[model samples]
Target: MNIQKLAFVILLFISFTICSFPSTSYACKCVEPKSPTKELRESTAVFSGKVIDQLEKGRTQFVLFEVKETWKGLNESQAIVETVNSSSSCGYEFEDGKEYIVYTNETDGHLEVSLCSRTHLLSAASEDLDKLGKGEEPSEQVTLDLSDEDEPPVWMMLSLLVVGFGLAVFYGIKRVKKKVNK
Candidate 1:
């Protein structure tokens, strides 16, 4: 190869490598968090609840809470709160069975929380709770018995029974036919 052509190829290779390895950075950063009073004023919902369940769908998480107290938007015994699924995306790490004082905002008609918010585990939020004072019970509280309402619907149970009976009858007929043939 000619010296000029070789130098041009080397430069092109270097340029391509630089472009291919362009550095990308990501992190969850929050400014100085607001005080409890300011957070209370700014938050769309302020409540204390236990994390009953969490469902992660792609980059989003749906957290079910058995709400214990309400200071703002929450009015039901149970609430579903949405959040980013990852901590790198600033999502809160909620533990199943643990309580929390959650400060949330309304996004796209749903409640969302993040590490950037003043939300914290109830064990770590004593100061905020004291500052906020006593919270009220949810206005529309109702307990659902998993033993009853969450059982398979009647149609589903009946379908299972019918399928079981049909399988039993088919096996019985097959056994009788084999015996007669013998």
Candidate 2:
């Protein structure tokens, strides 16, 4: 109920809220543009595959998968790739039994690539020139809405402020009442 105690409580609340917010950037679920080019360069490397499993390392999501067995271009090349899911903004939903092309590169560290929703690359669809209709639309890049990623939400800070002020007011009133009673 003392002023000193109230001030200390407010300070502690502020420090806790700052620590709770996210600091690390999240990886998007979508594939990067240079994935295809990376696939072309290496003769024998882990290019792509379906995500068989996933594990979380701190804030980063680690996607694990086997090599593409029925890949069309590479003549049956296969290798497992691990891509760090950095930001939840770009997080992907992995489907088992689906085929994908993986690309690996060394950036900051040894990093792997994941490109999804590429049914054409995977030999699942039939190849027919005349039978197939020519009205299919081209696929667009998948991008996450990262507008709120950097800043903490406004209401979050406001609520913290309200709670801190309320505590301070309650303590101030209690102190005044104790002095008057004495």
Task: Please list the residue runs of candidate 1 whose C-alpha ends up more than 4 Å from where it truly belongs after superposition.
Answer: 1-26, 142-182
Alpha carbon lDDT of each predicted model: 0.83, 0.46
Q: What is residue 53's positional error in candidate 2, in angstroms?
A: 1.9
TM-score computed on alpha carbons, candidate 1: 0.64
Runs in model 2 deviating more than 4 A are 1-6, 9-39, 42-48, 68-80, 84-92, 114-182
User: What's the lDDT of the predicted structure labeled candidate 2?
Assistant: 0.46
Per-residue lDDT tens digits for candidate 1, residues 56-171, read: 76477888889999998888898888888778889888999999999999989989998899998888998898899999999896763322235566589878976985676567
Report residue 73 deviation for candidate 2 (angstroms): 16
Measured with C-alpha atoms, the lDDT of residue 111 in candidate 1 is 93
